[model samples]
Target: MRIFVIDSDPSFQGATVNVTVLPYEPYWDETVEGNTTRYSGVNYNLLATLCQALNFTFRRIPTREWDEVAHLVEIRKSFMTTVIYGVLPERLQRWDFTFIFEHAGLYFAMPTPVIRPSWLSFYYPLGGYVWLAILVSTLAVCIALIQVMVNEDMEKVKNAMCTEQMQ
Candidate 1:
């Protein structure tokens, strides 16, 4: 909301704002081709938006280090900076930070889903009932085979005993 309360501060109007940055890639990065220094990234893009919102023009300091930016702000050579520095004691003595622009949190990237064509794929998605039925049927067949084998063995033993009695 309130980036800086420059409403009462006359030094803000049309101020040649010296912005120091850390060149955080995807946030701010300098791409130089011969004599031209072209800036791009999120912070670089934010520059135009911030200037328009505050009604002031800005120029970026060439330095990329955090300490150098702090020193520039300390000496009042720069109006402000574009770099996002952590709130540290040494830096605090030099410059005052405005409202927090961002809050860091856990970040994760998900992998792409695997694609495959198979007959089993259709059955795999079936609920527990299908698998349970398959398991129960297999078990029943196994028990029936065991019972048949035991009965056959018992009949062979009875026939051997009857032949022994006749002899």
Candidate 2:
């Protein structure tokens, strides 16, 4: 019952609030009939306590998914609820989120090398096309240098110059 309201009407102390929630796992979910949300997880559990403290009746409007809620919030929906973990810059621009119900830390699985360590790994970052381009360009530079050397001999100068100019 501890909901936070930011209205400048001192006369309005006790009023009902409609909050749309994005169903997420145990935090909040609908019973098979989609009539009411069953709250058990830490986020919704805390929300229950907050609602009690704030002394306001809340109406629940469940959204399809988190992505859908994100889109709705982007379009500036009238009411917002659910477990918002972080205050990202983009989210801040559209809405005013004032609650931090939980904190999620980053966790990434360490990649194991499928192939044993070898010097060949140096090319793993480059795509096949890039390697092919490098090989062709190197070969082209070598051929041009050889042509320059052949042209210096005077005998093949006209042929090399013709090939170089293409005219």
- How do all models score by TM-score? 0.48, 0.57
RMSD for each model, in Å, please? Answer: 12.4, 8.3
Q: lDDT per residue, candidate 2, 33-152, as tens digits?
A: 467544556556666666776766666655777777666656655355766557889868866777765676777998886794677689887899999999999999999999988877
Go through the candidates in order and give each one's C-alpha lDDT: 0.78, 0.69
In lDDT terms, how accurate is model 1? 0.78
What TM-score does prediction 2 earn? 0.57
TM-score of 1: 0.48
Alpha-carbon runs more than 4 Å astray in model 2? 1-16, 25-37, 55-59, 64-77, 88-94, 101-110, 117-119, 155-167
The RMSD (Cα, Å) of candidate 1 is 12.4
